[model samples]
Target: MTDTERTPAAATGRKQPFDLGTGPGRVLVWFYGVFTVAAASRSIVQMILDFGKAPLAYVLSAVAALVYGFITYSLVRGGERARRTALVCCAAELAGVLIVGTWTLADPSAFADATVWSDFGRDYLFIPVILPVTGMIWLRRARTA
Candidate 1:
């Protein structure tokens, strides 16, 4: 039998492009999912109730939520296209974290409130900074040869 014929997915006709839902990929998916929800909820509430206080921070949080949601969806999709999309998103997320983190540090007055990426996610234990790096590495390794 061919390689595809030997796998369970092939038997089931699923034809998984790569097994991103297994092992560490699962963990990455979970984290991204949580981040998506957390950021969305936080942004929505802040925008609704206190937008005038920190519009920039709240908007950035909403943007972060969107990115996290897309990355999570891509990871769970389990295809080459999805994987590549997730990889790009993860890189963007990392860059956002670094840029926002540095801005928050360099100019505290610029933001009246904190964002998901502020301080490199110090409020979230720096997960925002670390997760993208982990995701990129996992995605690169998860690619088919």
Candidate 2:
């Protein structure tokens, strides 16, 4: 299959992009899916139990969840449009990580608790910071593949 050619899925006859959900996209899908679940779960639990303690942190985590979920969905639903949307989302996610990471660091007392992007994802091994960059690179390459 070529970049502009889409092959029908065996079971559904739905056309899928030739370049997406293959090698690097597959890895991105996995990581994004995992991050979606992780961020969503953490935010949900924190909001329900201790939102009063750190509302900003919890809300930011939830926002990250929504972003991750959208990107994951876009990756899985491959098409030219989806790829473009995912690339844009990856850029937004990268900005969020950097901004939130710096905010948390500059004013540690700003949050009573840590968000997924806290200290550049210190508790999560900085995957929050790294994943978006990888995703953006893969997405840009996928556009030409």
Candidate 3:
């Protein structure tokens, strides 16, 4: 169906103000949830399997996972601070992926194992590399809308 013909009744309302965690926001929320689950699981597995092997990398992974979880929470909550926090978290996530991805590439021996940032998240189909960019775009759209 066409856009005009397919819209739901709730979407044709007079309450046109942007609801960041509703409608399209719901899709972002689902992605954030998935990221939270993936990051948390990876961190937990890394820590459990071999923390002593690469303490710094594993700890950073855990921190990144926690940050992802917090971002997920903030997106679902939907407020000024929540949006701001989401921005900051997305920026940090981008930075983390870049720095770690570069480092892992520059010296694979140092990592000695895979990380979310490794090879630009080749293992995760590069969603870790792409998510922050998409998040920043979404956040900006949400803010301006």
Clashes of each: 0, 0, 0
19-132 in candidate 2: lDDT tens per residue? 667788899889889999999999999999989999999999999999999999999998899989999998999999999999998999999999998998899999999999
Best candidate, lDDT:
1
**Alpha-carbon deviation at 128 in model 3, angstroms:** 0.8
* lDDT tens readout by residue for model 3, 1-145: 8885677656876333455677766777787788778877888888998888887777777777887788789888887678888989989998999999998889888886677677777888998878888878888888876
User: Whole-model lDDT for model 1 versus the true structure?
Assistant: 0.94
Supply the TM-score for candidate 1: 0.89
Off by over 4 Å in 3: 1-17
In order of TM-score, best first, we have: 1, 2, 3
The local lDDT score (0 to 100) that residue 114 gets in candidate 1 is 100
Instruction: List lDDT for all candidates, in order.
Output: 0.94, 0.89, 0.80
The alpha-carbon lDDT assigned to residue 41 of candidate 3 equals: 89
| TM-score for each model | 0.89, 0.87, 0.82
